[model samples]
Target: MQVLNKVTVAVKGMVQTIKYPVVWKPSLYMFLSLALSISTHEGQFYWYTNKEPPNPGFSQEFVGMVHAVGAVASMVGVLIYHKNLKDYPFRSILFFAQLLHGASGLLDLTFVLRWNLALGVPDAVFVTLEECVSRVVGRVRLMPMMVLSTKLCPPGAEGTFFALLMCIDSLGMLVAKTGGAFVLRALHVTRTDFSNLWLAVLLRNLLRLSALGAIFLVPTADQTDVLLPQDLLSSGSPAAAAGDEEERLLQLGKLTSHTDDDV
Candidate 1:
């Protein structure tokens, strides 16, 4: 009964969130990005599991190397973006990440086509490099969204609103897994039979690229005030309401600054 009640409250909260245009737009962009990337994410696992000779399943050592590279790249990306790209338009950065992510997916296709071998690149070297760059860009893509989620929450309901946004993020992953499974089965891509694997990867990359269409939904961090609803305006004097809003923004910034420090 307790769990049921909690679930009901969560459902109500989510419904309320969707009614807010500002929240829904960014949420949609995040969902689309996650859904589109599922193909590439699952494709990597399939590659490691079903690869053919000379580049068959990733050895334990290779997996460790990729992990190390990803960790280092993640740290570097976080630092650089925090210092440099933090203020850049969120949508623009996301679009750039989408392009880089597509390029990374293309690297998967290269392995599928054995282009790396044809080009005389060792499998380990190429895969490691691809993982490093792709993971870095992926980290960069997420930081802005995290910061945006924090800032987008209205006063006094931060926890519920942010959790709902994260739920959308999780929903994207769920959809991606479902979509990837469907595509893989449709393509007959089994653990051992990977003949149509390249096509599957191509499809994934295309979906990722197509997600760029939703980029416009993410507003710039600086544009938040401009996008606020007119309902927030004062009932009487415009000057007084504008002044009150400015004070609210100032308080919000202080709150965000403290939150950043905690992070």
Candidate 2:
């Protein structure tokens, strides 16, 4: 897990340096890759555990195949977007994708409940759905908010900003996993006990979503427009405006001196 966290942080740092628009689609694909990987793994684990002994491990193998497919898809997406990097910004794509992703999570709850009902454990469905919803709220919504927070950093600080974001996610996962295990052990409860815990978890996720929604209430940061060196020298700074005459004359004199030396 530690090694995985380091690798993810490094990738996020690299993502920070990528030019926008083209990066947007690839980043979305990357995020989906992670979400799908984690979700499928967890789903299979739960599904397998709930079954009888001598399980063939089919669910685990299936999830592994799904993750492999997601990896291939992400690679293809990157190649496809390689030429269009600056046409779309990251925030726009992230926001829209998250909205869609969140809706999908909510919609899945109905299907999950139907499956539970078919299995004659309708009560268990609520607990499973609550847990799934919490995960989706964190990954689909809060994760994007964390990424957006890094965009507020100064230009050269992008790597550090993203690294910190990754660290937070890693820590959050560790705490949630360990704490959940401890609670389950201490309570000596079976799978059915999860239903009793569903309300608390659901409320917690609601609070998390509400907090992320509040970020929209804040003002957006000023976008830094990329320009050529000549454009910067001509139009951008106070120094450029007041010393343009002297600066151009000085540059010309240096060029002439260099030419004379070359001769």
Candidate 3:
């Protein structure tokens, strides 16, 4: 019963989160689009590389090397975000990341066209470089998402609300995977054959680009301090706690009921 109550409260908080103009709207739309693009790209990567003309399959060693390089690149991305991007608005960081990642999807098309092979570059090297760069940017991009999700949790119900937000993210991943399978089936892409892989890459890139349209849903400033439970608890005055409780009530009321502005 206690677990059920927590789940209920968590769900209620999630509903409230959807009505939060600065958090939920952008997260919902952009997150889904990005997830779909990521899922499409990931689910198709093996087939994309294996279907290369003149070379039917990627060597396991070469794929391992590329993955090793990408792992290192991801670590570098974390350092870069900490040093260079920590001060930027979360929305701006996420926007640029999404755009850059979308542009990188075009690299898949270039691979399909065998553009680098024409320039005397080995397929292994080209794939390694592309994977490295993509991993770096992808890691940087995901940082803001976790931060924003944490920031959206309301006072007193922080644990419940944060868990609900994370569940939404996980749900997006599941949907993305399902959507990618549907696209593959729809396009008839399979391991031994990849006739329509170029179309798949294009569609994934377009979906990534489409996520940019939700930028307005991001808050312009760091607003996490607005309703911190700790702030209320640490006020050192009974009146302050009472006032905060009233404010929290009003805020939650606004969240549950449909106001014209909320709509």
Candidate 4:
């Protein structure tokens, strides 16, 4: 019963959070689109081991090297975001990042179609470069989202709110993976037959580009404007917000609704 009550409160908070316009659509777009876009590469790992042409695969060792390079590139991306893009507005940072994110998908396409080989680039060199760029762009695309989510947390309950944010992100990942599975099934992209894998890559790139359309949902303001809007900060709002929050806390048993206030 205690677990049930906590789940109920969490669900209620999630609903309230989603309904809150200052955070809803932007959060939805950011989390869902990025995850879904990445999921397009699902099963590609196995495809990399298949020994076929035009749809040919890389050796295990080469793939491992590519992954290592990509992992290092991801760390580099974090440093770049911290040092360079940390001060930028969420909208501006997301705009360029999404653009770069979508563009980076082209490297996937290039690999899938063996265009890199046609252009005289060795597979090892090309794949490593592609992996590195993708990781960096992905990190850049995601950092602003993490920063924004943190800023949206309410005072004194940041841990709770951040956990909810993580749940929301996890939900997006679930949906994306499910969607990618369906797409792969529909395209008949099996481990043994990856001829249609290029199509999947193309479609994924398009979806990544589409994330830009939803950018308008993101707020273009300071953290203060986002956490508690101007109206909420007005003279008359504190008592109401505090009372409402206090009542909510009591119901959740943090303040214990059954307890005497005077005591």
Best by TM-score: 4
lDDT of each: 0.74, 0.41, 0.69, 0.76
Badly placed stretches (over 4 Å) of model 3 are 41-45, 48-52, 222-263
Write model 1 residue lDDT over 224-262, tens digit each, in one string. Answer: 344434442224222233334555776898999999999
lDDT of 4 by residue, 134-232 (tens): 999989888888888887665534676678788878888787787788888889998787878889888888888888888887787653345645553
After TM-score superposition, the amount by which residue 207's alpha carbon in candidate 3 deviates from its true location, in angstroms, is 0.8
Residue runs of model 2 more than 4 Å from their true location after superposition: 1-44, 52-58, 73-94, 115-162, 172-208, 217-263
- Candidate 3 lDDT at 77 equals 89
lDDT of 2 by residue, 1-263 (tens): 54464455445544543333332333334333233312222332443345443221235465455445545544544543344322344455444444545454443343333444555554334434434444433344344344444543324334554564465456555654554454444544344333323333333233323323423432333223332234333453322233344457668989999999999
TM of each candidate vs. truth: 0.77, 0.40, 0.77, 0.82
Q: Positional deviation of 49 in candidate 4, in angstroms?
A: 1.1
> Between the candidate structures 2 and 4, which one is better when assessed by TM-score?
4
Task: Give the per-residue lDDT of model 3 (tens digit) for 1-263.
Answer: 54464455555545654565655665685467556664665445665456456532776676777789899999998998888887788667878988998998777777766787887887777887788888988888887777777776655556766676787788877877777788877888777667787787788788878878876766666523342334333552233334355568767877778575677
Name the regions of candidate 4 deviating beyond 4 angstroms.
1-14, 222-226, 230-263
Best to worst by TM-score, what's the order?
A: 4, 3, 1, 2
Model 1 pairs in collision: none
RMSD (CA, Å), each prediction: 10.4, 12.1, 9.7, 4.6
